[model samples]
Structures are given as structure tokens and as C-alpha cells.
Target chain A: MCTTCGCGDGDTRIEGQGAEGWHRHADGTLHHHAQPGAHAHGATDPRRLRIEQDLLAANDAHAARNRARFAHDGIFALNLVSSPGSGKTTLLCRTIQALRGLLPVSVIEGDQQTRRDAERIRAAGAGALQVNTGKGCHLDAHMVSHAIAQLDPAPGSLLLIENVGNLVCPAAFDLGEAHKVVVLSITEGEDKPLKYPDMFAAADVMVLNKIDLAPHLSFDEAACIGYARRVNPQIRVLRTSATTGAGIDAWVDWLAAGARAAARSATQRAGPRGVVA
Target chain B: MHELSLAQSVIEIIENAAARDAFARVRKVWLEVGLLSCVEPDAMRASFEAVSRDTRAEGAVLELVAVPGRGRCPSCGTLSALAAREDACPSCGGYGLRPVAGTGLRVRELEVE
Candidate 1:
């Protein structure tokens, strides 16, 4: 279990899945037989069941469905992940304001136990739905699937998913977003990318938020990008201050480009199967 | 922790396998865990125990086979061993080490009756 969202399972293959390299004693204990199928009572003896499966198979399947649905609907979804107090919501609200109906923007807010972020997003003038994770640290694909069914976001629209403000757990779960944008406030440590490598490693864009206060703080902007590049060389870096609306234009332009690309790509195929129309 | 949920998922897989393979009892589970992946073996063990209570997988031994991370250097196209995500390529000493392997969590085999 992770201190933040949750610990995730990785993918691995175990050898000797056949009727060999395993055994069970009449009494349950750490015991093993050196040979395969040594017991004469073939039906009664414990058997080695070959079950090679991924722990996240279920979640990955759900994410694949979500990804297909988003592509089919032409929805450009972005999953925002960051540590607490990175101003993710403020930046999202301001981004909503900046778009100003350029594209229908819908937000799905993930919080452990509050509707505050959803309310803030709704107040900023966008269709917002709150998915409180309760005791859970981050949102999962099943939750997003439900939210998508309810939101029914229009085609060629923007779906901004504000993942729970926790860096560690959200990295493991894929919500079928087109991109994962990680927000790190300038007030935070510049070594965040190295300290939380998993989050930085998973993100596509590293947004340096709260840049308005950089003049007063000792934040090293270049070093942060450098660290981010070390983990993910292809990650695009962006700086913004959601309060003053500074640098929001470039952010919007990025979003517009993605939205346009999504629309163009959506028209090229009939559905997830890639059937040309 | 999502590990708790992941542990639950393991049980679900085992139970599904039980139905598919017609097994009633499980003695041990062989799990291949990626060394670079986010999963912690100790934590997963505890969580698996906590979630497997009263289930067909109760008291099942989980043997973890560690898979080390492997990276490929982009500049020289040389494959190198990776201990961590921030590790520099040993062959080229370059920062652009693309992850080629590791980071997996899967149930490989099970000992059952």
C-alpha cells in the first residue's frame, strides 16, 4: 500500500507453471517436493496450475475501453497529477476561463473527500462532476468510466481530469487520458522531479505552476526542467500562474493543438477498430 | 493503499482460476514482480494476506521472482542495466536511457488442489 494514492502491481512472468516445481503437504507449511507430479494419487495430489496473469489486467482492460471511447468520441482528455497545493485546480479553473467556450470543456474532479474542487471548476464556467475517492487516494479507470457515461462530453471537446492531488498513486493508474500533465508549483522544491521520479517519469508535460512568486522565491526553474528531462527526455515543460493568468495563453494553445489533432484524428477512422470510412 | 486493492485483485484472479481449472484449495502462488515497478513485495505480501482471509487463497505462499529493470541508450542504441529510473547508461554514459524492460507485476503459477 502506498502512503499517497496506492501501490500498484507490475507485470512479470513466473516460470514452471506446469505440474512441476511446486507441492503442498497434508499440513500447510513451507514445504516443497523436488520432483514433478510425485504423488501417485494423481487426482488428490496438489497440482501446479499455470495462471499467468497481470495484477492490473482488470484495470488495464478498463483503461483500454476508456481510451477507445475517448478516441471514438473525439475527446481530448488530460489527467492532471501533482502533490498537494500545486494549484492544479486554480490552474484548471483559469484554463477554463481562458478557453471561454473555444471548445466545450468538461472537468472530472478527483478528491479523497471533498466537492470543493468540483465546485470551483463549475464556478469557473464548465460542466464539472466530482468523483470523491473516499478513503482511496486516487481515481481508478472504473470511476472515470462511470463519470464519462454521465458527463457525456460533446465531440471535439476537452475533458480535464483533475486527479487526486497526490503524486505517487496516480502514476500507476491510467484513466485513458491523451496526456498526463504534472503540475509542480514553483514554491515547491526544484528536486521534486528526482524525489518523485515515478510521477515525473509518467507525466508527458511538467507544468511549473505558481510562477508568479518565483521572483521572491529561490526556485531554480532551469534545474527543475533539467531534472524532469533526466527522467523523461521527451516531456514538454510549461510555466504558468493560474492566479494572474500569466502563461495561460501558451497552455491554451497547447490544448487547442491537441483538441484540433484529436478532432482530425477522430474523423479519420470509424471507431476504435480503425475502420476507414 | 492501492496495494490493498491490488491484493484483492490477486484473489479475484485466483478465484477465477479456481473456477476455470476446477481447483478447490490453493497452497502457494508464484508471482513475478518487476524490480522497477511501483509494487513493494513486503507490502504486497501483507496486503495479500489481509485480503485473502477466508478465501480459497488463504494462507497461500507468494513467491516473488524479481525482474530487474533494463534500459536502452538512445544515442548509441546500446542496452544497459538499470537500477533506477534516473540511472545513466553504463555503455554510453548518456542520460537518455529508454526503459526497455522490467516494471511488471504478474501471477505466474499457483500451487493448488
Candidate 2:
């Protein structure tokens, strides 16, 4: 049995389906037979049962471990995903500044190069860890695990992982967060969520940032919210402008509530067994 | 672009499959890209060629089957073959359209030697 998810079978042909592969038996009960002229060709057959699982499977396992670790440590983690220049770092800085006194906040900023986002977060008076993905486009579970170790926030703390500026790959890899929040600037089209449903579907919250520039731009807040709802009905939408501190309080309150909810769940899980008197 | 990473993932899956199947060379790859997947197929193909160089899948033809976005329209039932801008239901013109399919990105099959 596979230990990680306990769903692994020996069958390599059908991933998560059955376990049929080369087998050896002492009593000759069962064994897979080699195909005819197996050694004639150097390459494997293309029609062989596809036992190969997703390449991100390992990263997913690590993400699960990170999730359990965060729960055990009473840490509330949020995975923030968005496109480039969507103001994730700017919104994060403003949020950190606003929520610094309410609760202990930490950030894990991801980028292709430079610690500019981390520097911005630090300037806002919050603990920040920069994760440079180098050539990679997204932040995986292992990277977040390492960054968490570096942040080392106190129990009942909030940690935000700002994923690399990409909407697609980051959505495929979960970073062990209580919630996945997506930031969209007003400059981006209102139909963005419609165009990128998977990312919006994966997100638990959607922040429409840069509302201050709404008048200067052609962005429609209602249409954006409508499209976001169309992609994910359960998504909580928040409009904000870091430049003017607009809607900062509501976003901060939402973060605090999220942290409290996560901490409460962790405490309940650690308290006692289900059978109570 | 993120499509590069996705193409790399497809290569990994195919390579691992080849190793198990004992195939040395892959002739072609067929992939199903859903409209809602947000992956640009052109970019993905470019990335596949660039990253698969020198690998078992080098020079392999990447055939993409583009699947139209599927959606569940609140005004109607399941809808398919939707136009890029029109996500509304055909019967009732309701705007509540939840995607039902066309969000998958996977290597469906491989022709190997």
C-alpha cells in the first residue's frame, strides 16, 4: 500500500486505478509476462497502461504535509496567486501595515528575481521571507515548507504566501494554505476570471485591487465581481486601493477572521477526542 | 510563460511511461487542452519542443485537440461549443454559467517506436 495518500496500488498501467506491473512470485501464483521482442526495441510501448501519475504529485504530497504542519502549529496560511503587476506585493504591504497590531503577520514572497516584494513587506513592519523561484513560474509545497521554517512565526499567527506572478501553474500546485486568495488589478479586464476559470475556482477569496485608478481605467467592478462569482460562487470579493487605504479595514478584518477560524479549528482538533461526556 | 512548465510536466509523464513500457522513441503526442484550462496551445507546443530537445520525445509531433469550454447554464442544461465571449445559456440567456468541462490539460496518448 502506498503510505502517502494510501491510494497507491501496484498497478502502473492505470494510476489510482489498479496495480498491474512486473511481478515475481516464489510459488508461481502470478507474474507479469514480458512482451514479445521486448528487448528488440530500445523504447517502451506507447500503448502501455498509463500508470504514470501527475508530475505535481510529489509537490501535492508535500503540500499536504505542509498543511498538517500548519494546522498542528496553529498557523493560518493563505496562498495568494495572480498575474504580473497585479499589485499583490502592494496590496500585501498595505494589508500588513493595516493588520500589524491586530495579529502577528508574516509573508512568504515569491519572485523570479530580486527581493523587492520582501523588502516592501518588511517596510510595512511584518516578518517577510523572500523565495526566489529562479526560472520557475510558481511556488511549490516544498518551497513553502522551507520558507515557513525560515519565517518561524509564533503559534496562532497568519502567514501569507505570495505566489510567483502566474495564474496557471500556481493554481495546479497547492501551497498548503487555509485559503487561496487571488489579486486582480483594476487595469486588468473584468473578464479575466472568465478567461481563467481554474485559477479563480481554486481561489477562496478575490481581491479587486487598485480601485483608486478605476476612474482613470475602463475596468468595471460589477462585471469583474460578476465574472468572479460566475467562476466561483463561494469566492469572497473585496475591493481595495493600497494607495489611498481604501477598503483596507475590511480586508484586514477578513484576514483576522480567517486566522481566528484556523486557530480555533486547530485548538479544537488538539483538545480531545470526539466522544465527550 | 507557465505553459513551458506545463509542457515539461507532459514530457515527464510521457518519459516515465516510456521507461515502464520499454519504448525508446516517441513519434507523436496527443494532448487535450480545454478552453477553460487557460493554457495557450501555441506557447505550450513551443515550450514542448524547446524542453523536449535531446530527450526521448525529441522531434516528436505534438498534436493538440482543443476542447471547447463546457458549462452548466442555470437557464438551460449543460452547454458545449460555446463561443469565446458568449457564456450565456442558449435557451434562457441566463448568465449563470459554471464550467462543466474543458478545463483539463493532459497527454492523452503517445505513439512510440
Q: Which candidate is the best by lDDT?
A: 1
Best by TM-score: 1
What tens-digit string does per-residue lDDT give for candidate 2 at A1-277?
3222222344233121111232223332222222322223235545534342544566778899999988987888999999999988888888888886789999999999999889989998999999999999999898998988888877899998999998777887888898899999889899889777778888999998889997799887888888877666678999899889999899999889988887888888887799332
| lDDT (Cα) of model 1 | 0.81
Q: Which ranges in model 1 have alpha carbons more than 4 Å from their true place?
A: A1-45, A270-277
Q: What is the TM-score of chain A alone in each candidate?
A: 0.81, 0.80
Query: Tens digits of per-residue lDDT for model 1 on A149-176?
Result: 9998889899999999888888888899
Instruction: Output the TM-score of candidate 2.
Output: 0.76
lDDT of 1 at A8: 17
* The 10-residue segment with the lowest total lDDT in model 1 chain A: A1-10
Each candidate's TM vs. the true structure? Answer: 0.86, 0.76
Each model's DockQ score: 0.42, 0.11
Q: What C-alpha RMSD separates each model from the true structure?
A: 8.3, 11.3
Q: Residue B11's C-alpha lDDT in candidate 1?
A: 95
